[model samples]
Target chain A: MPLFSLKKNNVHQTGSGITPIVFSHGFGCDQNMWRFVAPAFEKDFKTVLFDHVGAGGSDLSAYDSVKYGSLDGYADDVVEMGRELDWREVIFVGHSVSAMIGVLASQRAPGMFSKLVLVGPSPRYIDDEGYFGGFTAQQIEELLEGLADNHMGWSAAMAPAIMGNPDRPELAAELTNSFCRTDPAIARAFARTTFMSDNRADLPNVVADTLILQCADDIIASERVGEYVREHIPGSRIVYLKASGHCPNLSAPDEVVRAIRSFV
Target chain B: MKSSGPSVPLSDGGEPNAPAEDLEDLYENAPCGYFSLSSEGLIVKVNQTFCRWTGFSKDELVGRRLRDLLNVGGRIFYETHFAPLLRMQGFFNEVALDVMTAAGEKLPVLANASERRAQNGDVLFTRVTIFPAAERRRYERELADARAAADARNRDLTERWVAEREQGELREQFIAVLGHDLRNPLAAIDAGVRLVLREQPGERIATVARLIQGSTLRMSGLINNLLDFARGRLGGGMAVQLDVSKPLKPTLQQAIDEIRAVVPERVLQMHLEVDVPVAVDHARIAQLFSNLLGNAITHGDPLEPVNVDVATRAGQLTISVANSGPPISPAAMETLFQPFYRGEGKASQQGLGLGLYIASEIAKAHGGRIDVVSHANETCFTFVMPIV
Candidate 1:
């Protein structure tokens, strides 16, 4: 494959520092999700940002249904990307489901990532026996149906124009105005995978020094879920933020930057 | 600024003097639900309309987070997509959500939210409006289903088209190989027949050998036509090698002579007026002429003389063959050059119906075309090409 074709992941890197800080975005959005926080560390670290295969300016054709059928496939990409960039002692910061993806990647390649910061992380979304994951099975199904309903409007209005200019920077900039615009089919699949995955069994195996940023009023991953993650992972610490939504990165970027700075 | 109409009474704050009770009434029972939430999403203020729609009193709704009234899925969407967008973009419009009413039923609504920021860039509160969308949601669901069905159908058609194209290419390749393989045996049989004829075998044996030779010649013509048809269908078209040094008169005469030997009783009148060193593919031209002559001999009235006109003038070459017979029907004329198209009521045993198609293809390869004219007395086929 050509070098540009690997831009299917749209990996972006900056800074002159030796320690690489790779930022992975959540389920519903792309790497632009980190715009408010990642730049804060650029002067002190080699800040890296990337979109997952099906999001943002990433090449949509690289999306394979079978490969992305589970979250493990996504973790494989992170590990592969680390190997490709030849980074050592990496600091991986992931938001939402990507937090769990970072955990999986660190476990897959034990010493590659040295530190992890999970913001509003949830090991599971659907509540299981003796555990409240913040949702029921039927409610997740309803969310999938709601996604289908909105996709009808979204694809009809935006897909053709966005698909026509995949490589245009102006188009990419325009897309950031909407922020969380994702291909509806890929969004639906990611939703099912993120909400349905059970990563509770994998948390205890994490060897990296981990920090969980728990935001108040985060309905997607509540404070209790964040605490649950901290309790399961050895040597992991949890900090409760005054910010109110799941995305403190956008709502309280200064607070998020402070939390990551103190930990790193 | 001056008021054009009667001056309205001003309040102490310089606002329009409307009835305070009416203003309160409008706020209490507006058509759509309206409310405001603190930056933390706790319901800071509420209208009676929103309270009534959710089956909750103002006292019950106030101070509760707006997400508490939503179902689990709606709550997740609010946190993940809606809240973040509202914070980053300052507004979100026409987002579909289901509010869990006090009666434990889902109320589908289209919600719009905008954030109010203070001068210091601190978010003071978020105002929201909600419209009942049960009917519209149902219609949207139907449209979504239809779009999904259309996408599936399009994918299926593309897959089938690719498979069909592959199968067609394989079939053409098979035909070309079959045509090539059959030639070696055919040449051997022709040579054997010629040796037998030269030895002057006994009369009955000689006659049988002559019949075999004729059959082999016809078979070879059929194979050549099959190969050309396959090549044309496979997108190579016809390949012609132009030889300017070779005289064209002998090639034209040879095609006529071959046709005459096949049908000795049919009368043919030839006219050739080419003397220039014409740049042309001699064998391909002869093949085209032979096909036209064979068609005329098979269809024309045997007693009538078939006219052959070959001439080069004005930097153009024109070869026309005219035969006297019954006029061709207009229906047959439309499909005359199409492959496997034989005339109506014609016996299938005469040929494979590819001769005219191959002849026309050869004409096209030479950057030329064949034209036809049929009248009450005669049907004519003409080949026209540039003499470059």
Candidate 2:
């Protein structure tokens, strides 16, 4: 297996009686983001964590622009991670933008994951003429400008705006710090790819039991996207967390854990 | 969703002279189907689109009214609502309507309609445009079905909860009375043993023996009452109707004699105020009298007088049993006649709650209802029934 040393993305094996749970991190962050949730699962579950190519400790040489640009490529990595570890019917929990990609991944490889726990994911960006996406064209252009101007400063300023609220002001800095830690070029490329994509049609064929736990106060991925996700996924359930940050697992991990535990 | 309607021809049953440019447009697409109707309600004119909708030709329907083309049920619905709305609204727009084609399949539509007004502002013709509503109609059906199912489930849950609450109350009351009912006979048995051991004098001996017999009878009667109550629950007496020609006095006498024997020393008296006879179930009448006597004995204060009266009028007989006792509180009176409903705060009383309940059920089965009125020193329970 070419000694698949993915930096801190090392694939360790521990098979307990409890069904395995896998975690996928969103753009601008790595599997370390799920550090709080991973340990809670360590005792009971065979927990697997991996990095998307070009992000986290993933090899910069292994980055392929054409394949990495599509969500299906990361989904492949998730399934391959499960196959390599030899876990069956595992619970795949994904955070932030990687949430919806988890659903698409499950649809691509049938029966690879038992159920999907999507924390925050938007199916489509650049809302159509009739639809209202919280952001205007000017705002998205400003975000791109913020990225181009002082990439680090943009991460600092935009993080609080997208990830946290005044009530949970600490989350703004924490998520921004998480974003600033990422490679700037890789983060910018992932942002462009996610914002430009549309997956409205693909949601219907999603047959996995879906739990969409939307943060009540995420500005970037607002509550309406949560509603759209629920409406598109047939027989899917959705609950709004009272927490006020984009990364709720970090801000209120107990509440997030309670929701996942209650549903499962 | 598009409806195939009739075609248009000129009056006197001839096709109109085609204007070359209008003819060209007609062959391609005109939103409304052209149809002419005779004064007698026959369709005279139709266009290609109307022909496609109704699956009929201009030649076939040159003399049929718009009503004749509609399905039987659709015709009634159109005349009742659609026609009036169209006339009053003056070209109704987006009217939700359903129509049947020649294939007898339903098509949902949003119809925008206008009448071809003449110079005098009277409608000589009508034009309608139908757009398909397949997706919207399907969604509406699903929404309605979900709401209806939820409502039905709620109603069922409410009924089940009420029944469960009633059952629980009945169980508590039944358990409380089970002790006293069984103890009465046991006490009588002890008294019989004491009398036999003591070898008392002649007068003492007879009284003690009568007490033992009366107490044992009350105990056995309680057991029998319990059995009848079980039968009544399964609608045991509904199949049996009262023999209207039967006499009522003997049955009342039998019940009074039995209760009188139970408490020989107590002054329980009967007063027949009316000599008229009644048409009723004799066995149930005996049961009613027996239950009334027991209720008076258990609920009335010690040494108070219990009085029974029977009266009759034109077609109904009214029987009243009054006892000088602790007045039944108003709250207790409300559910007094209910099964297992002893008076409020009277759960400790020494009577099976089933007595009054069984008596009332019997009354109802005999085509009557019974009620009670009470004051501090006087409580009267009355049973009224039609003679016929």
Candidate 3:
């Protein structure tokens, strides 16, 4: 198969520099989530952006339940894309669940990625014995239920009227009909996979120099989780940003860009 | 909740003072709950209705984030979809959420929120309004359940229908194969009987060979009818090759002779008045004539003569067979040409009931039809087709 048809993940390449900087978006959105941050490095680095299998412009038909049931399947795609693009000493910037996905990909292809930038990363989501991953099992189940409700036409029905914000023409143009539209069933499965994953064991196996951009007041991945990630990954350091949400790329893109620039 | 209005001056100038209304009381006691959250999502201020609805006082509700008041599901929604959308669009409307009360009860509500930004476009605070929606949620759940049940029933019915149709096709295919296989053995018996009769043996043996020959001929007709019925039912209709070069009168006579030989006691009269050539499949027409003649012999009065008429006139060819018998019942007439309908109380007949049905199918394939008329005096079946 041709490169684009192989994964059908809507991979886009830009920037003049030769060293590729791949940006993987987190859950709840697609590569459009990196609009504000990814462009900042276009002049200095070769920027690459893509959607996951079931989100945004990615081919939903390529989403196999068994393959995407675990985060490893997503990591395989990342590894395959890296090899297809023929990138060596690559810079990978991942947000939220994609952060862990990047970690897994780095481990699978040992020195393929030279620098790993994990923003609001969480190695595990559910709290285990002697581990405060921030959420309980029951809460994760509730989250799944919430996802079902969101996709059951409740939010979708209201999105059109709400998105007609005349005051923000830029937002209207940037959103292009849907901000974070995803296949309902795929989103539910992806949520279960993301929240139920335990990649703490995989953290120590990272060979590349890693940086964790921990945001303040992030409920999804707490400050403690960031510190735990730093301790596990050898020679990895954490940079605390003043931004207060799980998506600092959207909220505080400048700070995210600055942190990534200094690291890469 | 006192109304505030300026009293209109009466014509006689009686009362002028109006009652004053407190704005704070109206804001606090509104029908819907209202709250304002700081840019960080903390509750900076809340109305009395919201506090009362949640069973929390103003002191207890202050300085807490809005997500803290929501249930686990609502919190996750707020963090993942709600907050990100609000950050991007600056507003969201009619979002369904379940709020956790101080007493641990869940209050389902439809909430709407809009961000308030300063002159420089920096965020100040967000205003939120919520309405209780327990009844609406219950109705939606019931609708979803009904829809799901209907979908499952439709899927089940479609699957069963497909399975039944497949089984029917398979049965017809089996019948076609069986009919084809029965022919070879039947032909062998027919050939053996003919050979035995030609030897001019003893009278007893000659009579037995003739009986065997009649039985084999009847069996062959039954198998041919069965194969035709199977093919027609399995979507390949009766195929006919209309031949205008050969006259059709001889084929009809041959069919009558075969039927007469099978039942020599019954009298059959054939009237052929054909001067023009009729385009028709010879073998198929012969089969049709044989079927009608056989049916007449079995069902007609044994003493009465069965009449077979064939003629070409007025650009049409008509072949009809008539017999004197008891009138066919109205109920049986409705299904007279249907396959496997061997007439009620006539189950003891010596052939499968597919004869008339195959006859009708052959007639239809030739752009023709068979019409039946039954009365106390006589019952007649007419096959008619245009010469063209």
Identify the candidate with maximal TM-score.
1
Chain A of candidate 2: what's the TM-score? 0.82
Summarize candidate 3's per-residue lDDT along B1-388 as a digit string, tens digits: 1223444432444344643234555567788898888877788788889989999998788789888888776776677777777777777767778899999998888888888887666678898998988887777667766876999999999999999999999989999999999999999999998999889999999888888887888889999999999988888888999899997777887888787778888899989999888889999999998899888888888899999888899988899999998989999999999888876546677577899999999899889999999999899999999988
Ranking, TM-score, top scorer first: 1, 3, 2
Model 3: clashing residue pairs? none
Q: Which stretches of candidate 1 lie over 4 Å from their true place?
A: A1-6, A127-132, A152-178, A223-235, A240-244, B1-22, B302-305
Docking class of 2: incorrect
Model 3 TM-score?
0.84
Interface RMSD for model 3 amounts to 2.4
Cα lDDT tens digits for candidate 1, B1-388: 1102343433345335655334455656789898888876778777878888889887788889878888777777777777766665566677788888889998888887777877666788898998888998899888878888999999999999999999989988998999999999999999999999999999999888887887787788889898999998988878999999999999999888777766778899999999677887988998899889988887888899999999999888999999998988999999999988887546954687899999999999888899999999999999999988
Model 2 reproduces what portion of true contacts? Answer: 0.00
Most accurate candidate by lDDT: 3
Provide the TM-score for each candidate, comma-separated.
0.88, 0.36, 0.84
- Residues B231-302 of candidate 2 have per-residue lDDT tens digits of 555345433446656677778888787778767666777877555656677777787778888788777765
RMSD of each: 5.7, 25.4, 4.9
Report lDDT per candidate: 0.84, 0.64, 0.85
Query: Per-residue lDDT of A1-264 in model 3, one digit per residue for the tens?
Result: 369634578898899888999999888878878888888999989999999888778898899999999999999999989888887889999999999999999988977899999999999989999999999999999888766555444445335654456666567543744667777778889998999999999998898999999999888999999999999999999999999878888778889999999988
| Interface root mean square deviation per prediction | 5.6, 28.7, 2.4
